[model samples]
Target: MASTQQSRILRVGLLQDGRILEERHLRRPGDLTVGRDAKSTLVLPLSEDLPARFTVFEYRANQYNLVFSAGMKGRVHLGSSDVDFEALRADGMAMQRGHQYVLPLQESARGLVELDGDLSLFFQFVPPPPAAEKPQLPPDLRGGLWRTMDRVFFGILAASLLLHFSGAAIIIASEPPPEPELSLDELPDRFARVLIPPKPEEPKPRAAETAQAAAATEEKPQSNDAQDKPAEATRPANAQEAAARRAEVVKKVEGKGLLKILGSSGSGGGGAFADVLGGSTGGGEIAAALAGAGGVGIATEASVGATGPRGGGTGNVAGIGELGTSGAGKVDLGSSKKEVEVSGRVTSSTPEVESSDVDREALARYVKVRLKAIQNCYEKELKRNPSLKGKVMVRFSILPSGRTGDIEIEENTLGNDAVGSCIRTVIRSWVFPFKPDDEVPVAYPFVFSPAG
Candidate 1:
């Protein structure tokens, strides 16, 4: 529906040479005239076929009365239909707001106004809305006596509430504090005894056997040179010599198969003592074996002790100082390399593909739907002056998410900004079906003509 406010004013929208010339407004109810004369209300450019005055409009009784001058030769129209003056005379045809009327002159002097040039007119009317009535009330509420009584009763009730709360505060402030349930003097004897601490007991003396062992080590006889040098003097010498000697012994024993010797010596194997003694009663070799196993320089003492003791220095010794296990003397390797084997299988996969095509027919259908929403913007203006015609080219991009953006007018020749902007806004809101991983660009053209 057309707006009622549009009916309140008469608008003359003019177009000359395919461009907008001017727009005129008439808000008052009076006579309007258009012609070539200086005395006319609206003077046009010079033309011989046009009389001194060509047209007249009278606004009376909220209706416009239109008529042509006596000598004018051209025809006037509401859209494409010819005006029926006879029917207008019979009942006075009414002109509605938002409707367009056109006039084409046959003669022109200024090339600006051609013989087929059009003078277009559109109207806007706004009738005032009706007024509303005031509401009525009872006479009792309006009188002064009841109003005074209402105020006095409300004041009395407020004062009573204040007094009642003030009395409650006074009663709460006058109450006494609570008494204790028990006193500290009533506690029992066990609680008092916890304050005292008990005395500690003395430690027992050491055993006599342990005291004898300590004294024997302390009283052992020492040589004159050893007693003078002190125990700290022997530490460095022992460390260097022990490390070198132990390494030499380990190399010799490992090359001669110490594990095989130990195993055969304990078993009933032939030549077990032959391997240890090398099939000869060699005292020097026996002395060397005793010194290596004991980790001490007592080879001569061991030979003398063996000659006296139960044929025993070469016999199986259950415990040899630190030789409890074979692995105990093995060299440490910090980090060792390890080899791991792993095997795996791989499988191939195929993904689905989608079609990507620029369908002009599909795009045309979408543009047809969009055109219905914006064509009226140009139609209402184009209907008045039929000569104005041009094209609007809009460039836009469709995002992967199926939304339109970056809309811009590449070209516009519609002669007015409103028509171009209306079409641009509709183009920016267009949505197409989503294309996977693709962005589409579009440059669409729209043409407008009086005939269209």
Candidate 2:
């Protein structure tokens, strides 16, 4: 029975606050120590109240014994009843050694020992676990790479490489040879026509010459007419001869009915049918006779030389001089000015600001007002990487003149240098409202998040 009990495994576990912390299985008879020391078999967390080391289970004389100090307390399960340490002491079942208590355990015993009412050690006897089987490779894959690799895969790979190389070689062999290089002398002769410079274009004729050519063509007929006459007779010899020639030309024109059609001799009621032909004094008589005979009556006619209204006669229609003025005054078009409204919003996390000389709140307000520029920097990058969102801390100095200087990114959690650089540039351009007594050092953080 003792051999059989030792053959079975002794499983001991340490638990704290109902949670298992460490567990071990002992196959051979031995002492099990539990404590907060590193050298202990079952080491626990370091605690000032816990002892450095203590034995909880000891195997001797082919029997296991449970051990505990006097202050320790717990219960044990043996046979058919549950027994506490105090009960065991009162029944004289536990052996006292100075301040330690020892209780002999049976092969079937399982119990819990509580240390400081917080740490618990549970021991029980369990069957030994079966041995684990070792993994083994196949016989064919046990040697070198040549034997281990799949034959079909290796063949396919080798064939593919061979086919690629052969195809490349065939292409190289079939390629056409490059053309022979030409010398400079041969090149110039082969492309002589292309290399020759073209001749300069002829300039177009001027406007004056073109006009003279057209005039000469038009005067060709006049020259021909002059040629028909004797050169000496082309012009009249004297004034009387010139007048005589003019009169002859006029007489020939009148003989052709030109003077009669023009009413030059008052034969056709004067030329162009003037009502007062030749300024005749019988105008009223003609008008009255036409009226009495039911013919069209002609109004009193003024002489062509008259400039004003004639006595008892309707004058020529008045000539239009200048346009008359309109009575309307200038119009009022009101104001031409226009008003435009622009609106937008920029969202950002509250800036973590620090300043020595300047008021921290005022500095924060100044940063808040300019957050739009910083937001623009972040949004510009956000368009490229939509998932970009993080914190960027900036450090700058407020000069005595209210201008910013020494602006730089102190910390950047966004991992993007562009945003940090852009923000630094923007902050450098800012001017605080209040001038500091001395240079004020400031560090501000701005958090960015993508808007929904």
Candidate 3:
């Protein structure tokens, strides 16, 4: 019975201020310690009065012993009797040397040991807990892949793989042979025409016709009437015929109401108007006088005839010659040449950093790389006003995530609101390569000018 009790395990429990903290089962021949130290078997809350470590229970000579250190207060229960540490020391039942007392503990002994009146340790011998059973799957459910997988599914998968490989092999082996390559020289004419077409032949000039055309162009300045009129009406054989034609045209003009109308106005107004009309007897002379007076003129030359009155004149003059036979000539109203268009250039200067954590060189490099995008903002506005050229200073902050925020135009000598707004929008999209510990303030300036 003594040997059987020695074989049983000792159960030790720790209490803090009378509240149970933890319990542990110790086998025979094993020692137990309790203290605030981490290596102790039973650890307790740290206290100035408590020692770093103290052996509370010891197993020796096939028997368990209880140890009481100095300042420790407790009672030991043996069977139906109780013995205090002081009583044990007085009766010499417990061995005492210096500041510690040892009492042999029986299998049925159980008691509480207090440390500084704050911590208590309970100890006793008890049966050990039952051994845990090993986990296992049921016999019907346990097996390898053959028993677990569907046999029909596995067979179908194998058949499908075999058919796929067989079809691929048949198609590859039965493919048609390759055609022979042909040289460019041996190719058909149709292909030759498609690949290398013949150059078109330029028309050759006729020397006689060209010479006559050059002489005609040089002799007479090109006129719209000359181009529109019949060859016979455009050129007369001799001066006599030309003079005869001019007299005929004058006679025809006088036959109309033009002279009578002018004479009637002159007769009423008198002055130079009457004298000029009254003195002009011949229609040719009158037409010349009207021409010199900045009025309607009749051409005596065979190529052109009478024309409409100059300035603002009211009268329907009949027998005014053919449609393309009369006109002073073509007058240049304005130039057809285009005005030169100019573009403006946009550039940025080095950025000014106002942060201790952000790297100046890195910030400048990032700004330089994205400077083109910023410049694009100004250049878009610069296109509208070529003279748009000035400095724009932008203020912004780099967040901890390296993204820009609070972007605003601090100074815009450029004086264009659209440009400033565009710059702000562009800067807001910029993200630096580095993340800052805190937000960093930055100022950047840009200059714009028309490209020379």
TM-score of each: 0.21, 0.31, 0.34
State the lDDT of candidate 1 residue by residue for 1-452, as single tens digits.
12332344454444555555555555555667666788866676676765576445555545454544322223334444544433333343433323322222111101111222464332223343333577757776666664667787778998999999999999898977797676556656676566554567786666987899888777775555478787766454767797677667656664366544642542333335434543233423333445535454333445544443333444433334534555546576958777432222111112112234546566666667556565665665565555656777777777778788687778877677877777777766777865536767777777766543
**Model 2 per-residue lDDT tens digits across residues 1-452:** 68778578789998989999888888777999988888788987777777999888887788888888777789999899889888988787999878888898877889998875578888888998877788878976678887778999999999999999999999988968899998767776548667886698999999999999999999999999888788767789999998678667755765456434643435444333233333443433322223334543333325234534434465564333433766989786976776432222344444444445677777777778777888888878877777787788777888889999788788888899999999888987887887878777777777787775
What's the lDDT for residue 407 in model 1?
78
RMSD per candidate (Å) reads 32.1, 25.7, 20.1
Report model 1's TM-score to 2 decimal places.
0.21
Instruction: Give me the overall lDDT of model 3.
Output: 0.77
lDDT (0-100) at residue 439 of candidate 3?
83
- TM-score, candidate 2, is 0.31
Higher-scoring candidate on TM-score, 1 or 3: 3
Candidate 2 weakest ten by summed lDDT: 283-292
Off by over 4 Å in 1: 1-357, 383-385
Worst 10-residue stretch by lDDT in candidate 1? 104-113
lDDT of each: 0.53, 0.75, 0.77
The 10 consecutive residues of candidate 3 with the worst lDDT sum are 302-311
* Model 2 bad stretches (over 4 Å): 134-452
Q: For model 1, which pairs clash?
A: 6-124, 6-125, 7-124, 7-125, 7-126, 8-124, 8-125, 8-126, 9-124
194: Cα error in model 1, Å: 68
Q: Write the per-residue lDDT of candidate 3 for residues 1-452, one digit (tens) a residue.
A: 46766567888888877778898877546889977899999888878878899898877777778888646679989779988888888899989868788898877888988876667888877887776698888988778889989999999999999999999999999968899899988899999999898999998899999999999998676575677677756687899988788778866776467565554434334533355544333323554655445545554433122433333354554444534655588888777786566566777777888877787788877778777776777668776877788999989999999799798889999889998898888888887877878888999888888786
